[model samples]
Target: MNKMYKVLATASILALAAMPVAANAQQLPAQAVQKGNANKQTDVKNVPATWGQITNFVHDKSDKFITVTGRGLAPTDQDEIVLAITPKTKFIDAKGKTVPLQKIIDGHKTVKAFYSPNITKSIPARGTALTLVVQDQSFSAIDGKVTEVRDGRILVKGTDVYDKHDEEIWLHFADKATIIDQNRKTIAAGDIKEGMSVRAFYGPAVAMSLPPQSGTNYVIVNTNMEDVNPGEVNELTAGTAGVITDQKDGQITVIGQPLEKGGVNYVVLSIDDKTQIVDEDGNKLTKDALKTSGHVEATYGAVMTLMYPAHTHADKIVVKKAESVKIEGTVMPSDRTSKDQVYVNVGSDDSTANDVILNISKETTIIPALGGDTALRAGTKIVAFHSPVMTKSLPGITSAEVVIVTSDKDAVQPK
Candidate 1:
């Protein structure tokens, strides 16, 4: 019996795939078939690839699959009939996998070619203050929000559009429809507000056009730590302020906070270093992480930064002096050997550059400037101070100072 079922499934799929365009042409005219019309088109040839409908019977059992059998107006080609099912949020796959109501709607199929009005490509905006009469199903006032609406297209962000108590509805926009707000005014999208009432009109039911199979899962990294080390993992509390920017098997791009002008940048840590991150439940994770904006308190290791991680064979990194830090000095040659470190000469009076080795964190490493010597020249004046020495090593000054190129008294003009 199992083998027979597999064969039937394969045959059904093949029949649906092989359906010709001519078959759909014959049934387009009979779309207005009344609910109880005896002459309703039953043939699978008349149905479009996408259609919609609600379930006549709600199944409550270990196997949540519904046995859908409907009589069409005409005899449909064996594979021409398609059946799509969308169950409540509580529905789960046979494998015990959690299935969102949206996924069920997207994967619905028809047993015969004639389209089902219940399974549609368009989803309606949600609302609990209005009446929704589509096909033979009538749903009274349901709470929902208009997430998107543009030219015959609309999406609702709320629960209970479908059988699922918390499922949202994605419907098409209808310009001719009347929307009477709570204030009793027929307003536009701009006039929409919280707790507004809504309703929708329909032409033909549409369904999402996608392959029969499913896709793979994508990764996303959302954190609160900003100015973070390039590869160091940081902890970001869960909030709308966080976002995922990149996706991979194990890693994803995330961004937070808005960029400010003339602001400073700092590094929290580096890559290949493990830090403690936590899931929503407060469980910790030891992994590499990155952050774009917001505040995150985490312990991370130093890895390659936007610049050289350190003074190794990697390319040189450019370090800019902050305005608050002053620079004044005369050119003098000195030697130093370190891959990720830079040696700068500061006058005794210089407060910022008093420190020899500036730690820019593992994310950023100091390298020789293009066509420049290894050590800072005597005449090169620099202002520096300690900040978040880990990632961004922007100098901070305790006292204002300056460094400038100097010539012998005999070679300089008196001011």
Candidate 2:
């Protein structure tokens, strides 16, 4: 094998903010009709009406927030009804049409209801419909009951509602009330629309399940797609000729060139097909030769299955190409000596790259064949994928999926 080794990055892109649009506004009827009159209609009295309805249920999570738009109403004048309805509940719309409370929200405009974690809130109960008189100029109307007040949130449940204007109705709330609403909200099925924002409590249940927390956080790249190309490694003529210390099935261990002046032995393995390599005689070597010493390359990609030992140790490397991709970057010292493990510096300046400590060993090499390799350096210009590394306090995200860098002709360095 030859003594020419450079760090090839597998580029990929990741954007967690890529979420589904919430809801579209409800379309108004093409032909405008009279509200409660067929022929020459008489004006209805505008007296302050006190309508009542039930709150079926409320649901929520910590990370996601709900948005509630004000409907020109206040918390006091509006009557808050508490009621929990089941799939069998019946609802009546303004047209006196009977419908299931769970089938609304069909083509109705709905908006997100934002809430402060400190402020616990209640939403219409699931499968239930509620109605209240519109009063004041506030967009929101909350019925404050003094029975079970905790964290300043109201709870309601049971019963049906009456006197709700379809176009003028916009009630959005989350279910993470600091205090659970033993009483739920109620609703009439005919009034629900596809565009209406809802929680676990609303009629047309629009709830998405969340994946479990897997503790382990690492960079993943599909071996089939393009590799993550970090910037270029300047000072191409500064390092000593590298020597192969160990080589095995698709794995290489090289220790010779000093990363710094007197750095420790640096040994790593290229597991996938995206990892590339070349020998001292300018002979192309398979990624398997990485265990021996040579040139190599890597690419980036979107979502992939990441398997690690004990959810902490980087024992194996696996990349599954799906759709999105980005470049990943990490600055680890070659001084640290460890088998199938390396410390990465999250402080790297690669915009499209994500920095993460990586470990690749048995579980990775055990796989068949995937990804390739091409000669790359710390700063070698290359495309990459940028994803997010979630933490307890903050979130870490990359700029781009893959950082486009120079080609192979521009990546190779002097011996």
Candidate topping TM-score: 1
How many residue pairs clash in all the candidates, one count each? 73, 148
Q: Residues 104-205, candidate 1, lDDT per residue (tens digit)?
A: 445442212233332211011010111101122211112345555444334444443233354233443232333334333444544443333343322122
Best by lDDT: 1
Which run of 10 residues does model 2 get worst, by summed lDDT? 211-220
TM-score of decoy 2: 0.15
Give lDDT for model 1: 0.28
The residue-level lDDT of candidate 2 at 145 comes to 17
lDDT at residue 221 of model 2 (Cα atoms): 13
Instruction: Quantify how close model 1 is to the true structure by its C-alpha RMSD in Å.
Output: 27.2
Q: Estimate each model's TM-score.
A: 0.17, 0.15
